[model samples]
Target: MSATRRQVLARTGAVAGIAFTGSLTELFAGTAAAKGMGRAGYGPLVPDPKGLLDLPKGFRYRVLSREGDRMLSGEGEVPSNHDGMAAFGGRRGQVHLVRNHENRTDAEIRVPAVRGLTYDPEGLGGCTALTLDSANRVLGERVAIAGTSTNCAGGPTPWGTWLTCEETEDKAGTNGYTKDHGFIFEVDPTNPHRTGAVPLKAMGRFQHEAVAIDPRNGVVYETEDAFERPFGLFYRFLPVKPRGGLGSLRAGGSLQAMRVPGVPDLSAIQETGAAFDRVEWVDVPDPLAAETPIRFQDFGPKGITHAQKLEGCYWGGSSVYFVSSFARSNEGSAADHYGQIWRYDPARRRLTLVVVFGPDTDVQLPGEEPDNICLAPSGGLMVAEDGEGAQHVFGVTTRGEVYPMARGRQNIGTPEEPAWGEFAGICFSPDYDTMFVNCYTPGTTFAVTGPWHR
Candidate 1:
């Protein structure tokens, strides 16, 4: 971390670029640019004059929605803390975005508790739907679901709906909550009322993060985002009524946690290309967490595997890809590492370590703590960084080369005390033409279009 090394991709506080200025292309001149590093992903990021978003050449982003802005649907002001999201094809080639608001009761802007779409009046986190035309213009916005707590990351259904998960197990009596939180709710972009805001209690009630549905049989794989002792356990749900329409998961399902025989802690495998085969799943004695949370529950001597900061997942090919954001031994985790992306093959009952970040002190961009991930339209993975470095959405190549695709530049705080937000909800439109992501803190959504390297 010398001045010269810092200059390699120097990220100062100002050109830290919310109001932080500089031609990033010039800064990268002698290093990546001069060496022709743009071939990695799209090339090094060029600075933005507006200081909103930084992208590579031939790329552009439109600020689709901002927190506190009036909705085009006239529902209410946009809610804050945008987290996970998904994109669907709407009529006439329009795009429908079901975005998650990770708000709590004390949020600056709560998801408008629209009469019927509201789940619980006391709950504050929910999902919003926006219809954007072919030009990425917002046509209408509406609250798809509300009155839920900690609506973090969830995946889209192959049947054309969004699954929004609550990342909390907040009890109703505590913190003025009127209903118990932490359950997955299905949302139909075409019809919010059809969702009914009913909590899919069968999906388990612990700190849910993101879910990936196995299209082969409609089995849902879930991740936990807790750092509590005993950490978090990855879960799998087998819907009783598999693969139906919007309200199908409501029929209830059997929930289970993944257990790799000898690997109790996923962080213990620190190597990049390591693979753990023969995965096992144990039924959850109590998916509702009526007495104890699922992670802390007992499974006799052969306990389930645990990973820290389990977040973001999606179905890829015949497997489910998930993220263990980061782990620190001092935090009671079994081992320490920057991040880990795992591929679980349900057909073979195996878990493979597809990507592993740093255990080093310097947590830079690209490989640092990859959170929400999606299969890039062209190929490989588009990972959102949620670590100690300057936040960015990195593109990891098939050859394992990490490239900075987009950097967060919106200043959530004042220019004098600039605070940048992390990128989340990285998804592409159905036709794979536009990418949608969120700047979490002050809550901004961006629709990015670029010449993808397909």
Candidate 2:
């Protein structure tokens, strides 16, 4: 069984009573100044509830698809445990959504034709494409892409394509196929009828969870979703040619991991829940060939350090925003397990912490954990809830105005189910009037649409 965040925290000896640098009241009081949005509000827009989905007033949700539903490909049923997703504009006033199914064959809930890069009658988990109208109505659903391991969160390219990332680094022959694992697969939304799959091995193989590409430079920033080992590192894949297209990225590129110079071993400080204040950067060897990239710079006080497990990443104004789920505060008192959001500005080559959520701030109602995140249409952020009770879709305005956009419906699985409350992929439509969310458990997707108030 995979270790839960709580399990990992316990193993690291993280507990209460540690002194956090920012007090709960101070953190909440200085929201506007800290977030740089002027005066703003900080509370759930909607009250917490017990269900699978929830939304603000005047907004409604429709179930796009559920596990066990048949698709156009003649597949038996929709796979269980859906994860990351991306949207593409299609012809005939339709939108194509490429979704990820995070199921493995070993699990009890299984969907066929989802082994490692090959259709296995017994394995579950793969990618599917759903066609929707401009009004957020489903037109047709099909397996636009398939045959991958633990398909997780992925980013959409500017070239109108979807990059689906595999979140596993297990060798090919160990569990599933003999082919390489942990590679990004390109999906052509313009041509869903294509059969063959293209794997971009040049992106480097590791426990990749999410990726964001810079349109100007064609550079891809990735995050590692590792738990057991302390080797997870932030990586960047630089395309050989400037302004190169995604097609060229498939050919090859240089992969470099991030390093912070002059800092002490972050891993040890993290165990005590201490956050680093200094900043540094060291580039790893280019074109990292082995499964593990060589460490070129030692930024931590101790020689050579392991990187924190990075989850969601997005390219925003002038910088790349990423999240580290288990960063300690500087005081070495409290651990920010809920996670801290950071932004990396390539122009300045610096990293800055934008938001830090702890128990009091995150555990607002009863039980809740921050998971996947996306940029809001109004220039803020929308975070998916992967917590207990009912999962929620939350919005944080640029000014740090936090509100509840939706609440989960309780029909599919019990709150205690591991897959139940996890909200994975989230993205807004091209027009910015509609939002689509993927529920990891029960393997379902929801489209929420309404008029823009602002």
Candidate 3:
């Protein structure tokens, strides 16, 4: 009998949450390797002459947009610090992309203020919309939303919109202008000319990183990216009226935080094969927390279980896969870890660690802090590395085989250092033939294409 994909991954310790003790490079040793090629991906990475990026053989990239370039809308220059993004289908073989600019303060270029679209005139973060042909060639770009704060890693909605989140909990009058900062804003990619960007205030206000929606039940799972005393919390927003559909998210919802039944502290999950217990959600008294920040609110004595740095999250195969960027022997916890991937089964209420990054000595696959992960078109997963060392995009197959897909080689002469930079805003085109990603600094967006399955 032919084995299913899940069965194959389970056999290789990819889905079974088996303990792995080996060098980072050795993680792929069990996989079949090609002559002179790496263990999993398309051979070895070939360095680019432009000192921008390095990709495996046969794969090439083209810069779709730059930070300082003029906007296709002819309004203002393109902003910097591009972050989370999603691709949508457009008219006549065209693709629409909604990209986030993670600017917390005044940026190099600001999105022009329109009437109903502007949230705060002084705010400095928002999203941009781009139009590309079926071939992944960029045609035009425009500002979709403006005057939001710290537009960070957001998720794509089932109703065809990008839910851009704010990675901050700053309230009104603290910064410069008015209006609270930490709110999720929804941008419609289909109509770039339409404004009236609305903040999903019904969804709890906290340091939101990314969110994944369960299509079967309209439940939205959220991750917080906090660096304060309380750390981050994993939350779920269940729409009160399921029949209202996607619009109910803005109407209102019950916000709840996740908790492992017996485990009082999250630090217990420090080991390689650290298995999760049956998960439970506790009602958050105040979802909006209009008076106080939501994270600090005492849900109870136990409070909401906290993760070190909860980041990227995506919905895949009947589960929500989220990343804990890094956990260590900090004040709150005991275990030190480079990275951890947690899978939450909405149907079963089971949360398990599918994969954990080995010790720092695992240098060959130095994806220390995996952020902004997305499902590959053909199979497997692509992770954007946001670590202290040399950064690269790592590919993980169903069999747990890990290999480098792309490397950042910033030009030495440039003002930014060549040592390190992160690859963010990773997503595939509607056709899945090309991959779109961004380099955080000296901002550049690239469209990568090649034999993805090979």
> Cα miss at 86, model 3 (Å)?
0.8
The per-residue C-alpha lDDT of model 2 at residue 165 equals 78
Candidate 2 local lDDT, 1-454, one digit each (tens): 1335543332232323212222222222212212333322232233325444655556667789888787755656787778898887777668888888886646444544532334333334567888888777777776656666777787888888777777776555758665656677777665644433667777877777788887778888988776554446677888776476547676677776665554433333333223344444345543323555333333345443344556888887566767665643452312335556666677777765556544544333322345688766544567775655445566665554455566555445433543335677898777667788887766779887764434
Off by over 4 Å in 1: 1-38, 359-366, 414-417
Span of ten consecutive residues with least summed lDDT in model 1: 14-23
Better of 2 and 3 by lDDT: 3
- At residue 404, give the lDDT of candidate 2: 56
Worst 10 residues of 3 by lDDT: 27-36
The order by descending lDDT is 1, 3, 2
Residues 187-208 of candidate 1 have per-residue lDDT tens digits of 9987899887899999989888
Off by over 4 Å in 3: 1-39, 192-195, 241-246, 272-277, 360-365, 412-417
Best by TM-score: 1
Model 2 bad stretches (over 4 Å)? 1-52, 107-123, 192-195, 264-305, 327-336, 360-368, 411-419
Top candidate when judged by lDDT against the true structure: 1
TM-score of each predicted structure versus truth: 0.90, 0.78, 0.87
Predictions: Cα RMSD each: 6.6, 7.0, 7.8
